[model samples]
Target chain A: MTGSLVVVGLGPGNPDQMTPEAAAAVGSAEDFFGYFPYLDRLSLRPNQRRHASDNREELARAREALAMAAEGGKVCVVSGGDPGVFAMAAAVCEAIEDGPEQWRGIDISVVPGITAMLAVAARVGAPLGHDFCAISLSTNLKPWEIIEKRLIAAAEAGFVMAFYNPISKARPHQLSEALDLLRRHLPPDVPVVFGRAAGRPDEVIRTVALKDASADMADMATCIIVGSCETRTIERDGKSPLVYSPRSYRGGSI
Target chain B: MTGSLVVVGLGPGNPDQMTPEAAAAVGSAEDFFGYFPYLDRLSLRPNQRRHASDNREELARAREALAMAAEGGKVCVVSGGDPGVFAMAAAVCEAIEDGPEQWRGIDISVVPGITAMLAVAARVGAPLGHDFCAISLSTNLKPWEIIEKRLIAAAEAGFVMAFYNPISKARPHQLSEALDLLRRHLPPDVPVVFGRAAGRPDEVIRTVALKDASADMADMATCIIVGSCETRTIERDGKSPLVYSPRSYRGGSI
Candidate 1:
């Protein structure tokens, strides 16, 4: 059999959000590689084997999948959200660039899925309907100064923002510091959304003002969306309120 | 009979990219409302009615769907990519806020789909693996000044940028002007991916240097992704080259 490697996204946590292409890729693979939680999301066939690793072992996971595929095994690498968004796709590519020369010939393709930010945006109306930026707050690979600079620039540019890995036990003060920086630039009434486990059964989506946002409101599975100056919320009698940023922007100072 | 409305994304164009949740929402709806091209992507059942309209008539289309749902019909409003990303979800919410009071009571939900940027990013090997921003280059709704300011800020902030609605017949010069603005700040060899009809059968993804890119390479169906300073490309022996941005930044001057 010809060796092949396909990176697929399982989507947030909902089976219904998984695309047919991703599901088909998983079904046809002889070996699956991913983080423990994402690997658990897939149901292995009788003949398939799974390789589950920790979250910090992305490079190791990519090497394992590449090695298996080079030995003529059909391998699938999975990520919770779209693999291309700060996930396995980049890790796989990085491995191929640095691995053995023969490993370059292996067939590789990335199947897209619904990412967390967009899922959260859908759930909370369209806070990202206008121009927006996505920044990961984890300082594991990059410095906190870089994240701070991007946050400040994004705010000054009037782009609505989505922050991934906003808060975790390892770093408790970053999210609050980021929000404090935004509060200095953005309006006090700007809408902020905390989406935890979006698209899952126990999904929680709350829209708060920038003045009321706290770092403790988010965890690893959460995506925090901060709206632009134009973002607004519509009040409903008995239904959940809707929040969105209008596509048009009137003249304003940045 | 109770009424309901769902705004769903159809992914880029490939049926395999459509999520099961969005497919089910379309399957169960009595009325389908969308742009002519998007509505054409869906197959109607025997009792389902398709309401296809022009692209510029988003508000009118939202009103029509709301009116139908208010009269006890299950309505599905569809957009090509994720409905919440520069699509119909915001329009529907706007209509609900501005329209008759009775429309607010209609059950509405937004089902997320794979957006064009993520689909294109997957095809091009994760240029968005790091911090990124997405901006619509269309000056139809917003002013060219704001777009220019955003381009400058994003470039200054070292963000991988995705440009949606890059070029159209009416605004032929906006993309070139935008590229020219970026040329002033970014390096000349930065990789730029022009992905047209991203996941569709006729999908075309081409990577060119910042200096070699032109306006005619894109249409409304295209999403232009510009790499950050850290983005790199790997040459293959006999296959197409792969492009990606590394997750690490090694102390670069912004």
Candidate 2:
């Protein structure tokens, strides 16, 4: 039996957001590997074996999956959002590059899913309607200086921004520092969206002005979106107000 | 009779990539509105009415959909890829903000889909594994100057960049200019992916160095990904080499 491995994204917290391709990939796998919460979200067949690891064990988990696939075991590595975005796909690729040469022959593919920022954008109207940037505030992999520089550049270029891994118990100060960097370039009234556990039953989405935004609004599970200068909010009678950036730009010289 | 409008994405050309929520939204709609090509891709139910318009009629189509929904019709406005990204959700919101007050009362929601960039990233490995920015190369709505400025900022900040609508028959020079600007800050061998009609039957994905990248490599259907300095290409025995950015950054004062 020739083994294969596929990295599939579960897509936020909603099964409805998962693609048919992703579902099919998951259904066919004999072994599943992922972070504990994500692994717990799946219902496995009686014969299937699941390996749930901590979040910090991405590289090790990826190596294990590759080894399983090499030994002719069908393996599926899962991620909460699109596997290619700060998830298992890259980790798998890194494993392939550094592992035994024979591992390269295994069939590997990435199945995309609806990412957190886009799901949050849809729920709060289309704040990402125009040009945008997605940056992760986690300092575990990249340095804090690089994150700060990217924030300043994104704001200066007038791109709507989505911040992933915005806040965590260990890295509490990063989101606030990032927000302060944005405040230097963006207006005080710029709209900011704090979306916690988007697409889940316990999801909470709050829209606040840049001046009123606080770091306490987010946690590791939250995704935050800061709108460009063109983003606007439309008040409604009994529903949440709509937030969207207009498709056209008029401020920059034509 | 209550009216409702749901903007749904078909998700990068592949039917398998379409989410269950998007499929459900389209299934229940009495009327469907979208650009001609996207509308052509769908087979409507016998009772459903399909309104296919030219690509340039987004706002007008949005208004018509809103009007129909306000008149107690279940309307679905469709776009390829996620509706919230450079698509119909923002147009519908803009229509609501500018249209009569009654339009705002119509139930409106956006269903997200696997966007083009993510689909392309999955196919070519995770070059978007780190911080990234997405910009549209089309100069019809925004000035070329702003696009130029954003490109410079993105390059300076060491972002892997995704350029949507990279080239078209009407505007061919913009992509080359964008590439030339990147050539200044990015290394000569930085990987550039030209993914045309990604996830479709005739999908084509080509990875080249920045030094060899050209304007004619893409058209409107193409999504171009320019790798950050950290992106690496791993050679395989008999398969396409994988391109991905390491999760950790080693440059810029780590």
Candidate 3:
């Protein structure tokens, strides 16, 4: 007999944010697999096996999760934000396909959660209703050159942006360089919101101009949202927003 | 008697996607106010006052809702997504501040649901992690020029995006124009995902290059999630983008 696997999204960083579907999967799981940091938030049963680790042993950690699921454990692989969105769902999927049994008859369900984009978008105003793209400044996978090419193209096209892995200890200047590329084509006062530790304690969401935001940020659990040329920020409620665009309405009495 | 207002998010477009907290709020409310489209989803009490309307009468209908709560009704103002994130929470807050004795003692609580951003991100890989922004393409409140600026700035700064109102009847050409702007800044091959009726029936989530996505998409219910330059479209087990950026180290015994 084979057990099922469910990849649940535990929200950004709050227990209350877990969906009923996600919470149920977590409560009923025989084993939980996730990153060391993200896994600590769950209140797993005593018998549940939690395979968590630091950033050093990613491959080994991913493999162990499959072994548990293969052994007929109803494993709940959790990820901060949504599992499929730049999180652990793919790793789990990869392991299942590569395993000896091909994970046949194993129910794999991907339950959704609040990702960083929405959390940050809510912190700011509604800036995500157009043609936009998300980019990672982390150069671990591809060359920085390729990243640069993509950034340049996105900038020229005027796509709004959600940035991930933007700045870390090692890659300190990537964010700045990317900003410089934007400055070339876009105006200096475009809306850039830095959402630090969104939905977590010490959460800080502040909107600033493109130039100002570039200088004021550090790399500790942050998501950045940059707007287009048309983005505007008015002090409607005494808040600092350099918003990109407003709603174009005629008949609607908003 | 003083009445309270609870703004609960219904999480994406699926009932299963609703959070426990959100469900509890809706389940316990004596009166409900929302767009007519979502009334069928929530099971209100027989006597529950469910005020629904289309877009043309949003504010007037909402004002009437305020008057209802002003007269002391335990109201649950519901929206498709998070209430505070571009939904009716702000209007409720404004009504609370603007009205006289009837609104003075009313309490307002905001409960978040899975917004379109989260749903789109989940459909794609994790591009919304680091720095991101969501912008509405519909120019109902602001002008198109402002949106273009925000798009330029956000894209230039390497932000990932989730586009709400990416396409609608009135804004058909605008979406393509927005896509063109994004394509100019980003690579032609940058993956942009269109989430049509996410979590609802006829839900279509397809990740294509920015160049290819601009054509053939126009729906009011559509949400577009565009990947960062680093975001890839992998065909894993014949699946679309089962993963995204910020690859954590999976280092545990397998």
Candidate 4:
């Protein structure tokens, strides 16, 4: 039998948010590979096995999964949120490209899921209803200067910005620096939404203005969305305000 | 009977790709409002009613849905992809913000789904593996100059770009103009993916180098992804090449 390797996203953290195709991929695989937390979400059958690893060991996990699939084992790699967005799908493709020739020919399919940014955006009104860009705050792969440049460009271009991996125990200052940079370009009233563990039981979605947003509002689980000048907020009586960027933009200062 | 308005996404025409939460929302709502084509995707029960409207009538659709929900009817507004991303969620929110006082009090929830860009990114390799921005080429709601400015900024910042509503019968020249702008800043070998109706039965995923990409390759249904400078393609013997942008980027000249 020619075993195939399928990389699937488990959505953000909710079972209800997981796509049926992704859930089916998780069910069909005999072996699973991912970081421990993501793999922990899956309730596997007795015949299946899981190979869990450290958080940042994406390449090693991908290589091991590819090797097993090459040996005709049905392998599945799980990722939180969409696998293609700063996740394991790239690592798996990287492994296939650099590995043995047989690995290239192995069947590989990437199943997309509801990414965190989308989940977070849903909780808010529609901050991403306008044009937007997603940037990871972690400097593990790219330089901080590149992040700074992208932030400036996104702000100046009037694109609403979503920041992933915003702050962790290791890097706590990047979110603050990012906000500081945005405050210089965007209007003070621009909404900033900090969505922590969005869609889960402990989901906390908070919206603050650009002038008041700070690093402490976000954690590693949090995805921060900073709106453009055209973004607006609707205040409801005894309800959390709805924030969204309007679809129409007449140059700047809307 | 207090009513609620839930805006749900029907993931790029694939039922299996729809999340259980969105499916649940669709099931619970009695009245559905959306563009006719998007509403046509739903296999509603006998009791469920669909209020189909024209394509450009977003505000009218939102107001009608909100009005129905305010009258103690469970209403659902459907969009093709994620509702918050350039879809009906913003329209709904805009209606509420600008509409009557009671519309604000109606319980509203936005359910997320697998967007076309995510589905397209999954079909190919992870071209959106790093920092990325989504731009809509249709100049219906926004100015052409804003789109032009974003395209240039996204290119300068080295963001993998996803273009939604790439081309239509009306706006045929925007995609070509967008590509011409990218060619000025990006490397010629950068991969451009044209994923038309991704995840649907007639899904077509095609890739070309930036130099060879044209507006003719795309249609209104296509979502075009232009890779950053770091995007790479791995050629297989007979199958289509896998295109991905490495998570790691060493500033410039990767």
Candidate 5:
């Protein structure tokens, strides 16, 4: 008997943001594997078994899930945001590449969901309306120098940036370092948004200019978006300002 | 009476991919405004009305939608993918910024949905697992020279790139020009994916090396992803290759 493995995203901590395809995958799977918090988001039937692991145990979790699938069990892997973006999909693919041959033969498919950056971008206006890039602030899987280089390049190219995993107790200094580097390249008035737990009940979305933005405004749950020069804030008489990046750029044909 | 305007995404031609929040917004709104094809995706109630227009009239559509909202009518503006990303949200924000003062007082919220690039990435593998940038190849709102500069900067930054509106009959040569510019900066063997009508019944996804990626491979319906140097393709025995950019970088601590 041949079994299958499906990977799906929960979409930025809100059930309403999850896609129907992901919900269907969750409903059909007999076993679920994921980081503990992601797996907690599911209300599985009694027949479904849960295999929750730590945040850094992606590869091991992938291997175990693949083995279960190879054993003719319907398995699913869950991720917090869009599975393809710095999540379980890449880990599962890497495991299939290096694991036993049978693992490659198992049926595998991925369902997309709303990523954190997109959720955060929506809460604020459309700071990502034009060209944009997403970078992870954590250096656990990449070097600080590479991150710095990318920041400079993104600024020079006039691309708005979204930063995931912006801060944690372990990597307290990186976010500040990144912001300092960006301050040198981008204008002081550039809008920087700190969106924590976007789409959740206790969500916090704050916008500050580059000169006033500090590392303390963010946490591990926050997704930060730094707007390009073209980004603007519209102030209403009685409401908070709406921030957005205009579609048309300078020297455009329009 | 205070009216609200909500802009939402239909998510790459699939009803299953549309978020519950977006669906709720659509259901609550009395009137819908969008381009003709995007409006065609919706099935509204008998009381609801759709105001469809041509593609290029974004500002005019935004103004009309905002006017209705300002006059105490529930309004919704729909876009194909995530509205914040090269879609209707920016146009709506632009209209609000330039229109009458009361337009700012209307309640406005944006609901996120599955973007085309994320859907295409899930179908193959996680090509956007690492740092990535998205650029629109259409010159209707931006200059060709700006696109070229951003392309060069994205390549030098070691970023996987996603191209939106890559080609059209009017802009036939832009994609080729963009690829030729990347050929100078990126490796020839880097993977280039053309994902046409992703999540739709007639979807076609093709992967080729940068050297083989031609303009004809893409159309306005396609979302093209260019892998970074770190991206790899794993070949299965009888199945198609899975493409992914590993989460860890070359100089990563892991």
Candidate 6:
């Protein structure tokens, strides 16, 4: 039996986003390894061996999946969103690469999921329609200077930004500092979208000016969205939503 | 029987991303209405009526889906990614609101789909691990200054960004100009990730300094991601790939 590894994205929340291809992989899997909540998102069949854990247990989870794949059993390793983004797809790749050569025959592929940024963008209007970028605030691999330099470059380029992992318990001022950097080059009226737990029951999406978002938010679950120099917010139907459209237009049909 | 609208996201490409709930939604859909490519993503039973149209035929697609719901059928308005993000979810809502109250009785709920941003993020790293924003570049509905202002703000605040609809045949310089503005605030070394045809074959995920990206890219099928100060690229086994962790300490674990 030729075992395969399918890494799936569970999406921001809810299951409607799952595609037919994603479902087929899950249904065919003999072993399912994923984050706790992600595994819970599925109702398993009888033959499936599920490996569920938190961040601390990722090592254990990856090992089990690798072993299963090595044994020639189809395995599904899942992530919350697209596995390629911030999830475990990379880890799986690494694990396979480091594992025994017998595992080389396993087919490893990634199934995409919806990231929180797309959900936030929709809730707040077309805030991400133009030139924009996304960054993570985690200081783990990169020096602060590198991130700072990128921020400056993005700001100068006038791209909208989607921020993931903005604030944990320890990194409080990083976001504030980021806001400060943006203020130097961007205009004061720019809109910032604060999306908290998007697609969940407690989801919150608010579009505020650049200056106000820093004061209004400070949480780990939050996904901060800073618009470009041209982004704006309007009270459409009494809903204050941020919108982004290109400036130079020839008025062609879309 | 009470009818409902369960909008689904098809992920970027292939199947592994489908959650159980999302799969069930599609499986149970009595009628599916969406673009042709979106419909091609699913395997529907023969009983389901698929109203697939050209990409530009948004109104016809919405009208057909509305008719199905009006007939008291469990209908789904499908899209490639998150239906809410520049897809058919909003249009379905609008159709229900504008058409008749009879459609209102049909339970109107949104099943959030997996968005492309997360897919791009996973591929490139955690460019969006912090506060960030998204801005659309389309000029169909609103003005361009709005996008500009939002871009400026995102840049000034040093938020990561996701740029959708970045460039098309008619609007090439919009992304370039936006990049120029971002350069004013963001450091020259800030990382930028450009994703084209994300999740689909021919997908491109690459990170470079913001300055280099402006001149290098200008395509419609691309999703641009800009990193904050915290994002970094690391070489694993002599292969350098972008990696963004939430914090420096957390990064140590990876």
Off by over 4 Å in 1: none
Model 2 chain B TM at 0.97
Residues B1-254 of candidate 3 have per-residue lDDT tens digits of: 66667777787777778877688788778888888877668877788778787764545655677677667788887788766455665555444444564554555566667877777666654545434566777776556886787776666555567677766666578788888888778878777877776767778887777878865764777777776565545454533554343343221101
Candidate 5 residue lDDT tens string, B13-118: 8889998888898999999999999989888988999999999898999999999999899999999989999988999999999988899999999999899999
What's the true lDDT of residue A128 in model 2?
95
TM-score of chain A of 1: 0.97
Error of 2 at B209 (Å): 0.7
DockQ, computed on Cα atoms, for candidate 1: 0.84
> What digit string (tens of lDDT, one per residue) describes model 4 on residues A106-198?
899999999999999999789999999999999888888888989989988888999999986777788889899888888898999999889
Model 6, position A57: C-alpha lDDT score: 59
Which of 3 and 6 is ahead in TM-score? Answer: 3
| Model 3 per-residue lDDT tens digits across residues A150-250 | 66656555556777777767668888888888787677877888888776778888887887767447474678878766455544333243232332322
TM-score of 2: 0.97
State which candidate, 2 or 6, has the greater TM-score: 2
Worst 10 residues of 6 chain A by lDDT: A245-254
Report the lDDT tens digits of candidate 4 across residue range B1-254.
55899999889888889999998999888999999998888899999998999888999999999989999999999999899988999999889988999888999999999999999999998999999999988899888888898999998888999999888677889999999988998999999999998888899999999999999999888999999988899998877899998888855552
Pairs clashing in candidate 1? none
Q: Could you give the interface RMSD of each candidate, to one decimal?
A: 0.9, 0.8, 6.6, 0.8, 0.8, 7.2
CAPRI grade, predicted model 4 = high
Locate the minimum summed-lDDT window of 10 residues in model 4 chain B. B245-254
DockQ of each: 0.84, 0.87, 0.23, 0.89, 0.87, 0.19
- Cα lDDT tens digits, model 2, B1-254, are 55999999999989999999988888899999999889888878889999999987899999999999999999999999999999999999999999999988889999999999999999988999988989988888888889999998888898899998888667879999999998988889999999987878999999999999998888888889999888989877788878998787868522
Q: Each candidate: RMSD to true structure?
A: 1.2, 1.5, 6.9, 1.3, 1.9, 8.0
- Distance from true location, Cα of A118 in model 4, Å: 0.6
Which one wins on DockQ? 4
